[model samples]
Target: MKFIIVTGVSRGLGLGLTKALLSSGYKVAGCSRSRSDALNELEMSNDNFKWFPCEVGDATQTQTFVSDACQWAQAPLWGLINNAGIAKEGVLATFPNVDSDELLQINLNGALYMAREALRMMLRQNSGGRIINISSIIGSRGYTGLAAYSASKAGLDGLSRALARENGRRGITVNSVAPGYLDTEMSSTLSDSKRAQIINRTPLGRLGTVDDVAPAIEFLLSDGAAFITGQTLTIDGGITN
Candidate 1:
């Protein structure tokens, strides 16, 4: 059986990715800041699902989380989804230092820690694996109020490109998926006017959903995507185009 790890499995896109992986017949070991009732329910119902509590920004905690997951699976891990992330929005000029640091810690460093640890395990197994970082369209495009969040995501894209080149010879593929505005709690804070503006700009006439994003990640983990690496797959309804 294939094994994969997904961070931030308690809600939103992370939860959707976990469900997709489980449904696709892969055993998933997931983590979040806390175990939510929804995650607990999933764990209880799905024999192939396991959940752990972790603060991905903490290097020690991230290392331990992946170590424990690798041990629990007792098999070669096939893929990793660096899906755990947080966003802080503010104008660039006044974006608080504290929020900037925290955003980088969780959004950028968290994915780095997980991917680094997972890569170690994948290398030892001698069968290269997939690493898909969940990024954002804001990383590539400019948005006035999300300077810190955008920087963190752009960093993820750079990480993916560099890692893919470093590990390509070993069959380990590293890539990123950058989604546009999504209808999740993450975007719920936006004003109705802002949301309407985004929808009007999007050719699809709507924001993305977890379902719209999860399949791209799942595909990256599939054999068909073996030839694809070091790329950022944008799911923004052609907004970037």
Candidate 2:
């Protein structure tokens, strides 16, 4: 079975993506800052699924996580999903310096560390692989109060484009998925009015779902998408338009 690495698998979109990948018969190496009961249950049920606790922002920890994953899989990696990220919201003028730094560490540096290690493994395997970075619609279209978050995500998109160019010759493809507001815990804190406003603005008249996003990710990792790289696929219900 092909092995895939998915970070931030303890909850929300990460959890949904892990479940979807496992269901589709890929061996998944997943990680999060802490172990959740849901992830433990998944581990117990799926022999193909392994969970590693990691702080993706830490380069050493991330590298160790990927190395251990390679050992555990005992095979070449087929794909990687740099899905670990944290959201920090504040007006650009007063956004705490600490929060801004922390946001970029997790959202951008984390992906960088993980992708660097994953690329090492993929290169050693001498086989083409897929790397999918999870971004935000806010990256392309700025949102008030999310300037730091948007900057980090926009950096991730730029990273994807550069890596796609650098690694294409190695048979590895790099791309990103930018999703708008989804019906996940991250969006639960928004006020009802705010949520309604977002939905009304979405041409689909609803928030995006994990189900809606996971399938697109799955497709991007498939052979069909071999020719599609250095691109950002936005799943925002046309809100960015």
Candidate 3:
């Protein structure tokens, strides 16, 4: 079985993607800073699913997680999904320096660290693999009170692009999926009026869902997407349009 590693697997898109990948017959090694009941349930129900505890922003922890996950899988490292992130809402000037640092470490530096570890394994195996960073539309479109979050995501895309160039020759493709305003925990803080405004502006008339974005990740990992690299796929409800 092809083994893929996913980060931030406790909830939201990370959890959803883990389920989808397992159902599709991929062995997944997932990690989060904290365990969720959902993670426990998935492990109990699916032999293909296993969860680990990890804080992606910590370089030492990240290194250990990937190494341990791969050892446990005992399968070819096929892909990696850098879905671990944290978002803090605040105006740039007022946002605590500590909070901004944490956001960047987790959202951008963490992905880079995860990709580095995954690429090392993939390159050693000499099998081309996929690295998909979970970015946000705010990276490109921008939003109020999320300047740090936006900067982190924008940096993620830049990481994807540069890594794609660096590794394309090895058949390893790097890309990012930037989902629009989604009905997920991350976007739960939107006020009622703000939520309504988003829905009205979206061409599809609603927020994006985890399911809506999961398949795009799956496709990117498939043979069908072998030629695709360094691209940012926007899976919004045409809101970006």
Candidate 4:
């Protein structure tokens, strides 16, 4: 069985991806800041799933988590999803004491750290692998109160592109998925009118679901996408188009 490692699997898209991957029969090692009751339930029923508590922002902890996960799976890692991120909202100039440093650490640096460690494992295994970075539509387009979040995701996209070039010949592919406004908990603060405005602008006339994003990720990691790399697959219901 293929072994995959996913970070931030406690809730939302992360949880959805974990379930989807597990159901698809991949041996999954997932981590979050805290244990989720939902993931705990999956563990009780699936021997192929393993959970770990990890603060992805901490380099040491992330390294240890990856090491332990690889050892537990006892197989060469096949794929990695850097899905742990924080959505910090604030205007560019005056936003009540927004910690700029913390924003970069969690969203950008955390993904970088995880990709770095996962790359090490993939390289050592000598098997081609996939690395999917979860980015955002806002990463490409700017918004009023999300400068930090947008910047982090933009950095992630750039990093993925660079890594894809660096690792392609080594049998590894790195790509990004940028999702627009979805019904995830991260977007629950949108007012009804604002939500409607977004939906109306989208060609699909609806907000996306976690399911919509997960399948794109699965495809990118599949053999059919072997020749694709250094690209961002935008699943925005045509909002960006």
Error of 4 at 205 (Å): 0.6
Clash pairs for candidate 1 = none
Q: Model 2, stretches more than 4 Å misplaced? A: none
Task: Give the range where candidate 2 is weakest over 10 consecutive residues by summed lDDT.
Answer: 86-95
- Candidate 3 has its poorest 10 consecutive residues by lDDT at 86-95
Candidate 3: tens digits of C-alpha lDDT, residues 136-206: 89999898899999999999999999999999999999999999998989889899999999999999999
How high is the lDDT of residue 238 in model 3?
A: 91
- Tens digits of per-residue lDDT for model 4 on 108-153? 9999999999999999888899999999999999888988888999
- Given candidate 1, what's the lDDT at residue 76? 94
Q: Which stretches of candidate 4 lie over 4 Å from their true place?
A: 96-98
**Which regions of candidate 3 fall more than 4 Å away from where they truly are?**
none
The better-scoring model by TM-score among 1 and 4 is 1
> Residue 199 in model 4: shift from native, Å?
0.9
lDDT of 2 by residue, 24-73 (tens): 99999999999999999999999999999899999999999999998999
In model 3, the Cα lDDT at residue 219 comes to 99
Cα lDDT computed for each candidate against the true fold:
0.93, 0.95, 0.94, 0.92
Candidate 1 C-alpha error for residue 216, in Å: 1.0
User: What TM-score would you give candidate 3 relative to the actual structure?
Assistant: 0.99
- Model 3 sits at a Cα RMSD from the real structure of 0.6
Over 1-241, each residue of candidate 1 has an lDDT whose tens digit, in order, gives 8999999899999998899889999999999999899998999999899998899999999989999998888889899999898987789788899999998999999999998999999888889899999999999986888899899999999999999999999999999999999999899999999999999999999999999998899899999999999999999987777
